[model samples]
Target: MSVTRTNPALTLGKYVALLAYLLFALFPLYWLVKIAITPDRLIFTEGTDLWPSTTTLDNFRTVIFQTDFMAFFGNSLYVSLGTAAVTTILAAGAGYAFSRFDFGGKKIIVAVMLITQMFPLLMIIAPIYKIVASLGMLNSLTSLIVVYTAFNIPFATFLMQSFFDAIPKDLEEAAMMDGCTRFQALRKVILPLTLPGLGATLGFVFTAAWSELLFALMLISDNESMTFPVGLLTFVSRFSVDWGQMMAAGSLALIPSCLFFIFIQRYLVQGLTSGAVKG
Candidate 1:
């Protein structure tokens, strides 16, 4: 029997739909870049223009030289990286146990984790604040890191559990048969296979922490301790808004996240579990 190929029209339509969705998603980013490069005088005049009539890098220069953007960027980086690292490690460990073990209270533990995700963050904010205050971590970057890590862990743990489930137990068992201990098998065989999951978890947690504003606003009082999301609020004074500077800072803040995804996107594409199981 001859295998039939997909119809050309259907394939073309699928590509068309994907292209349309991509353009729809990316149009805002295009507009942002357009606004960032446009001269202040032309900003109002060139409203909705695909290309700016005049462009200048002065907005970026002013944001960098005349603002506390670097400090905010550094704070965001520290918090995001710290949250990502801590969350990923905890999630990975929890996920491995969830996937590999059969123990009493496992179902109850998972149900409780799910329940934790059900509550609105507003309900817990007061208690979280009180706890942080009691620990003298209020208004500190460490507070932000702790809060972000805690908030992100449940979801990251679920993500990691899915990844761990996708991996085969036989691989670990085989390693054990070859004289490797459990830890050695996990470190040498399973850990390499879980890199994609780890990368995705790190990226997810980092972006979540980087964009979080509510906890940062509530916990951090010092200007020097502000993350980029809260720092962006500085442009919104009581009377006037600094649109140019805000957009410039927003654009700058996108760089690290972009670079991070670019570095991890390769591993994310690889299906490390392809050979781990028998079909």
Candidate 2:
């Protein structure tokens, strides 16, 4: 057998490209952390510097102790988790139906879901506001959960359907042949295989719900119910914006999403690698 040799130049080029992409993507995040640590007084004077001469933790101290950032974070967490759970459950059921059964008007139903995604979100904000007000759900976390689930279900359904399609029907059928019920097969065999897909869908929906600003701003006027995105706006005023404190708060806000990804990274990696090999 002959040994294959890889080109060193091509390998070097790939590493260089990856490093460049990483730097580009991470640069903004680095800047956010940098500004968060920089003193407010130096924020303007040394804003463009690669490094600040002095740094302080006062910004973080103020954001955590002096403000209601924690409350806003908790509210955001509740809404995001609720939305992700509800959407994932509904989407999984819907996707399973679409993948396994032939039903009349299925195409029409899918078309409608796609159409909902097509309309500019801004166009429906007014109608959504009116409906929330009429239902007396304004400033309610449950209302945010409901609205977010409704908006996210279509896309999440598609993602689940793709994963289900990747799975072979023969596996489920064989489980049934071996005395397993459909639901039993789903719970034991199918779901285990789809863990990666589930993780991906959950992560996507959680991040979206967490970061949504416009709807949060429109629907929640009560400070107690305000999510992190809306609460961040309080750092701004007509006359001035608190740059250091705002950056500090923003960096702190990133913790949940960061931890979420860290928890799910294994599943995400497995999913991508499996997809690549299977494809």
Candidate 3:
């Protein structure tokens, strides 16, 4: 066998490129936090400065205590978690069915879902608004949750189906051969393997619902029911904006998404090997 040498220069170049890319991507988030901590008086004066001459926690303090921020936060939390949980469960079931079952109209059903995604939300928002209004569900968190779940399910189902497709059907077959019912085999043998898929779907749906502004803005008129994205607009007024407080709130808004990813990150890892199975 011939030995080969590694290219140190190429390796260094790759690392340098990756570092540059990461800095470029994360710079905006850094700026958000930077503005958040900077005192209000210096916001316009030192806007371009990488670091503020002076910083304060007053922005954070005000966002947390001086406004209806907590109510908005709680409303968003409830809607997002409710949407994510409902969407994930429904998607999981539908995905498994699509993956394993050969049913009539499977192709047609999939095509319909794909078609639904093709139309922009703006195109159908009016009809949706009319329906929700007729039901007297306007300005309600539950309505937001329901609408979010409905809109998210098709894409979420497709995402989950791709994950299910990645898993081998033989695992379930083997479990069934040992006398487990289909549902039992699915629960005991298949679900554990699909943890990565489940985690990813949950994360995706949660992020989507959490950041959604248009629907929340349209459906929720009541301040008590507003989600965080809508609530953030309270910082803006007829003539001015509260930059420090707005940035502080934006920075704080990132916490739940970060914590959620942290919680599911382990399940997001793929390629855990088992000696019992050979591919």
Best by lDDT: 2
Global lDDT of each model?
0.82, 0.87, 0.85
Q: Model 2: clashing residue pairs?
A: none
For model 1 the TM-score comes to: 0.85
RMSD of each: 4.5, 3.8, 5.0
Residues 86-201 of candidate 1: C-alpha lDDT, one tens digit per residue: 99999899889988999999988887877777788878889998999999888799878878888888777877877888899999999999999998998899989999888888
**Per-residue lDDT tens digits of candidate 3, residues 170-255?**
99999999999999998999999988788878887898899999988888888888899998875455214788888898898999
Query: In model 3, what is the error at residue 183, expressed in angstroms?
Result: 2.0
lDDT by residue (118-202, candidate 2, tens digit) is 7898888999999999999999999999989999988788778878988999999999999999999988889899887888889
Name the runs in model 2 displaced over 4 angstroms: 1-19, 262-279
Report the poorest 10 consecutive residues by lDDT, candidate 3. Answer: 270-279
TM-score of each: 0.85, 0.86, 0.86
1 versus 3: better TM-score goes to:
3
Q: Between candidates 1 and 2, name the one with more favorable TM-score.
A: 2
Number of clashes found in candidate 3 = 0
